[model samples]
Target: MSAFLRSRLLWPVVILIGLVALNVAFTDHFLRIQVKDGHLYGSLIDILRFGTPLILVSLGMTLVIATKGIDLSVGSIVAIAGALACVQISDLDDQNSVSGVLIAVGITLVLSLALGAWNGFLVAGVGIQPIIATLILMVSGRGLAQLIADGQIITINSSPYKLIGGGYWLTLPFSIFIVVALVALTAFLTRRLALGMFIEAVGGNAEASRLSGIRSRGVLIVVYTFCALCAGIAGLMISSNVSSADSNYAGLWIELDAILAVVIGGTSLAGGRFSISGTILGALIIQTLTTTIYSIGVPPETTLLFKALVVTIVCLLQSPAFRKRVARKRPRPPVTQTPVPVSDREPVTNR
Candidate 1:
């Protein structure tokens, strides 16, 4: 039992199970399933639906963290993507058509790629710190988005656009399908190739990896690019959901949430290791926790406080010092002593 508990996979599994149990206990019919419009409906389905964007961002985040880097500009990129997409659609009268929507999505994708390249160049070529580099975008991307939208929220009345964020297929939200597809693709790429190992090696020791001819700079660039692309995808989903582009709130504070999800999933902030499955689980946990809070009628003002407390507890539990203290508190078996009557008598005679 002790050996099983100490296994690396045990904690994450336990955490996932515990969260599921908590949701079942606290929420009314947490996993209850129903049919609507010939589609499945349930709280679990809702959790996945809402969690898609976070899961996407965290997937990219896992890669960045594995390369010992961070991207704070994802939220901004999301804003930028939405803004660009809306601006493109605003110029067209038939914004509800397939062609217009495709054009907007394409434009957003291109812009996101360029923005990612800029971040990658700064971090990899100019030797800027990842946080500082991304922070610049985090601040400027919104401004850029606002500029594109002419400081107005561009309303989109497009079926295709709505489908991106709010549509359903086969009794499940399309966003959920997108997230699953991306997760599977990412898992395949990382697992089937040398990318995961290379990223981990670079994060573990950049100098050593470079010495071994791993092209660390190139890896960093790719990581940033991937992060930006994920942010772009998330932007599409969010903007589509509202059928409007509001740069101000499109993806506000999303980067922080992604970071939290990654950390909660047991991915080290300091880097060198990552877990895609764990990140997906972590995203679900966050969504479920949020739902649980709202279902119980917790005030909006106190939600942040509750989330903070949960994060604090999870972090503390993961701390090495806490683990060591727990280990020290465990009882040790006693040793028994044997009698030595003959030896005691011989020693007395010698004295």
Candidate 2:
């Protein structure tokens, strides 16, 4: 029980539950889920639906961070991917054609893979710092997206494309299924296939992992590539939800959110160990906080401040170093001795 309480994931879970309970306290029907048109409808479902993109991005960020690297370009990749797909779909003669939409998605993803490869090259092949390498793309990739968008938002009119984000399946949001599948796939690859050990080894110590017969450079490249791919998928979901791609704002500051989620999920930014389940919870917490802000009528301008405060609290509570420091500050109980009766005492006889 004590170990469980001390778990890194424990705080995030507690925070998430607290947020849910807070919402339930404020809104009478916050916990209620009703099915209409064969689809679930409720605040909970909405949270899951809206938080899907962040969860996906955070999942990829988890792997990247686990490899002792960061991908600051994910937000830009998201914008670039969405804009490219929207432009493709808009250009199709039959925008409603399923095949055309699929083609567009494929093209966008393929290009995203290429972009991921580019980041991988800069970091692994060129020996550039991960942040600096990804930052270069972070700055330039948005411009590339704007160019694809022709400096305007591109609205797509494809029903099949829309299904990726806003559709329902088995009476649940389809986006939830995507997240589940991706999470499962990631778990299988990392845990079942021992990929996680390699990642951890690389992140724990790259040079040592290399000397120990692991291909550090290849691992770094693969991790970055996978991270970008996740961002690409998130981009698709974000744009499809609204049926349009706003190149400038499609995924603004999402990288920061993703990093926060990853950190909140107990993945160290310094890189080594990571937790997928924790990340999902972190994403949920973030989404729930947003919902809570609106439900409680927090002014728009103060929302960020409110969120930062909550996040800071959570981080501090979860930090082992902080916990130790706090523990050190706590006063210790003084030890007291009782006087022994003369008849029963041996006295201070020295031999």
Best-performing candidate as measured by TM-score: 2
Candidate 1 residue lDDT tens string, 172-222: 899988988888888888888988888899899999999999999988888
- Cα error, candidate 2, residue 220 (Å): 0.6
- Could you give me the TM-score of model 2 versus the true structure? 0.94
- Please give, for residues 192-264, the per-residue lDDT of candidate 2 as tens digits: 9978999999999999999999998888888888889999999999999999999999889999989999899
lDDT of each: 0.85, 0.93
Candidate 1's error at 17, in angstroms?
3.3
Which runs in model 1 stand beyond 4 Å of their true positions? 1-9, 330-351
Predicted structure 1: lDDT: 0.85
Cα error of candidate 1 at position 84, Å: 1.3
Off by over 4 Å in 2: 1-3, 328-351
How do all models score by TM-score? 0.91, 0.94
